[model samples]
Target chain A: MKDTTAHIVEVCPRDGLQNERRVVATEDKIALIHRLIAAGARRIEATGFVHPGRVPQMADAEAVLAGIGPHPGVALIGLVLNRRGVERAVATGALDEVNYVVPLTDSFGKANQGQTTAESLAALPVVRSMAADAGLRTTVTVAVAYGCPYEGDVPVARLREAVRAIADTGPDEVAVADTIGCAVPADVTSRLRAVREVCALPLRTHFHQTRLTALGNVHAAMLEGVTVHDASAGGIGGCPFAPGAGGNAATEDLAWLLHRGGHTTGVDVDAVTRAGRWICDVLGVPPRSAMAHAGPFPTSHPPRGPG
Target chain B: MKDTTAHIVEVCPRDGLQNERRVVATEDKIALIHRLIAAGARRIEATGFVHPGRVPQMADAEAVLAGIGPHPGVALIGLVLNRRGVERAVATGALDEVNYVVPLTDSFGKANQGQTTAESLAALPVVRSMAADAGLRTTVTVAVAYGCPYEGDVPVARLREAVRAIADTGPDEVAVADTIGCAVPADVTSRLRAVREVCALPLRTHFHQTRLTALGNVHAAMLEGVTVHDASAGGIGGCPFAPGAGGNAATEDLAWLLHRGGHTTGVDVDAVTRAGRWICDVLGVPPRSAMAHAGPFPTSHPPRGPG
Candidate 1:
């Protein structure tokens, strides 16, 4: 099998918890991060620096970071939307990287972060500079890059222009997000191709499993030469600002898909599934992942005759 | 965009309900078939002609066929296990096609149909002859073509041998089924390529979403030029004989993926989503489809600001 080793950025702590109606205890959030680390997650989005009133589930960002002290080898990431958010992340002294969000459309930009698209674009370089000055690796994630809930079908020309603007910000990496999970494989292929035309930075993809096309989209991205992808443990996530958004691609499921496709994600599927089930238990919600329920393939139990 | 017109074989009435704990009413099963036809499904697996004692959910197969009567542009398919099932289906006078199963592994063959792999292969030609004499089209479906719950992964060489045997049976079409849903894109690509090298017959694919790799596998098959695929409305399905099997690839989700990929499946996404929801209501189970809850993209609703 050809080696197609991939990197999975665990985002359960930030994007996964941000949409839950019930807030997770700070200790449990820390425990989830610990569990994900034990499952071989080297890069994890630990928490977001958004307003508590807007996303209550992520209100304990500082406390959770304080609870999870320092760990060698693992890169902790903090999500931020603006300059103030970047400052908060830098103050925590916990995150090694800070991911800044830049919505592709004005509607989502206003609803999600109270900024216009152009305003967010203008803040991108400032946010990157602030994080870089603070010794934090920077990644700019273009939110709603596939299709916006309010402004449907973002054109390739628009995405190319946005990628050009984002690339100019000099971020360490760029991630295109399917905020509403409306993109299919063709969309992923076309959009990623367009993004690559204008930007040569390392590409990452974040997809929601709302329409059950996330895995297919991931496969398309891999075929397009993208190696880094984002997934939430147990597939627990949704966009609080995007109406009807669903969970991110489950980390365990994505690991299984990649491993079966001859890609080494370095993430243990069984441990991630346990963590997914554990977090789902913490939130009092059923897991949205198939691997959480189906168990891994190649069982040792002998086959039985039909009952 | 490539003109990849695909054929969707809606299997809700047969494979979808067969594993349900609560047996669906015959009238409701017929109603589902009608609704699927209304949603532009030209090919449908209406029901199975199997031992009622073995699969009680399909006990009302004859009644369902009687209720449906006839439709002008639809081709109703009936799933069968052995020569006896072919006879029963031929006597119904309702089925346009008979799908006979040939398990790739002996353990699954015995558990599912009380026969060994060799015995099933021996009976395939006889079953095909019986169905052909009755003027019914034939489709030989190799069960667990991807992986078997009892025998783990089915080797490509084994699949090639089985497809050659199945081809000798002179069936109109061949369907390789991931009954245990253990296949990823690479598995689908390699296995289908192996089958194609041995057989020149038109190929189809049947996949369960047990591990959520069904859509990805479908996309892989489409890339391999196998245009006919199987899916169930509401994604309601599992194999009672196959331990830990989940639902089939959902019709609405499959349609959404294919339509977005620029392939014409001729299946209406909204109508199929409504039908999926309706069937889930009757089955007293939440829909296993994403489109059922997220609704179709490109919504008419205007964007709203954060509350």
Candidate 2:
């Protein structure tokens, strides 16, 4: 039987593109989202409804959201950091899910949102209530869940305390973001174990390739039973703190790692690699995904279907 | 009982310095070896006894070999490619082990050694016999065992056939080299399994970080009963295929992966990461190993010990 066990969310269109210096014309962002969904992503984080003054790249997020075709089984997600972003995202009526991000480290939260971690936590309840009132699936993504950049490392106690505070918001899922990519496999497994103790909800993992252990960290998380993963086409994504730090684990590379580990990622490796190589030309940087230029497994050399 | 299981062979002195265009001083190579042995590497690939005219990088290999300080238990290994290389290596009286490399793919062998795969294979038995007669431990390292840059995906049939041919030579062990970073976890497990069926000797797997699957591949190999791993200090080695293609798997990263997997790697992750960062600066490149920047586990601004 074809497995339908997990969901892979391709976040390149939104998270990946938001950091670029060159504007990717709203048309390209729209094109990227549609392509990711067609390529087997059940969920795509389409855009963030942040203030244009803060993220001008996402100013036209509504247009990108408008461009998506009505995919019957797929979900469109939009990110929001505060109540205003949520209200704006709710106005679009395009997002099935709205993710609320609250970084765990005070230094990171202050830099990212100009507030302390406690202040972000205080806002989560109202934001979660608003999304729930709008019948939206609420997910709270804790930035630097495994560790942090400015703060060095976020302790399990610090993360668990944030999880407890956010748990009061009644979100459906909690995603641990390795914003600075400082996590090793041990860090991933230990933090996931600690969080699983307090929160009984589904867990998701997001990793960056800064230290090359992103995929391995994902594997360690999956071994502990994580059901959803966050990735970008061509591994394109960035942190506001570490500019030009390669892409979020490429959707194709993540798919390859999962499939090789005997899990069904359901994303085509060749098609994704080709798309990554194509987008590198668009972005003018080599992909952070290792498998992109390394070529596909020869046996997996995508049969052209007898044409 | 404390685990006595993890074994890693440091190859920086040989693999790290082999392809460099700028000639590093002989004293530096010797100092590097002194540090690695002091840091607990039981085996080290010290130098290559190749023709000086062809690989200018190794012109002082003999002199470097002569300057080595004593390590009571450390086994010094030298890389060899043919009967002549083996003859020259055994003459050193410095090598406790000689790794006879046979390029698995014909294209790479020709590019690397100006010989066809068949010629390299035909030469293995003679070298193995000579090493056996001289009472030196001979390790048959099949270069590009996982994938070849010149020749795309190398078949398991090719690797197994090569192993069987070399096994007949009665060498002490066999190692599979990921010449390019083309190997993945599934390949490591599946291909190593096929070889396990044909040969019962210990298996040593070496990998490159070219594609970021290096550590993942190593974890899979260890799961399949591989006891020995080959890694370079500071993740400082690479192939001349091109810059950014990737170098050898960084020593610290591999140790971290294995240690976190509940297996022993017997190397210090902090020391190795520091070495990786230092050596990267020495070579003027970002570390080839991922964990160099990603510090140790549970590593958040913990109390620095009197630093």
Fnat scores for every prediction:
0.66, 0.22
How does model 1 fare in lDDT? 0.90
lDDT by residue for model 2 (A66-149), tens:
888688888889999898989988988888999888888777777677767888889888888888888899998999787665
* lDDT over C-alpha atoms for residue A277 of model 2: 66
Model number 2 iRMSD: 8.4
- Chain B TM-score for all candidates, comma-separated: 0.97, 0.91
Writing each residue's lDDT as its tens digit, candidate 1 over A154-215 gives 88788889889999888999999999888988888889989999999999999998888889
Q: What is the lDDT of residue A242 in candidate 1?
A: 90
lDDT of each candidate versus the true structure: 0.90, 0.76
Candidate 2 chain A, run of 10 with poorest lDDT: A298-307
Candidate 1 residue-wise lDDT, B106-138, digit = tens: 889889989888998888888888888999999
| Model 2 docking category | acceptable
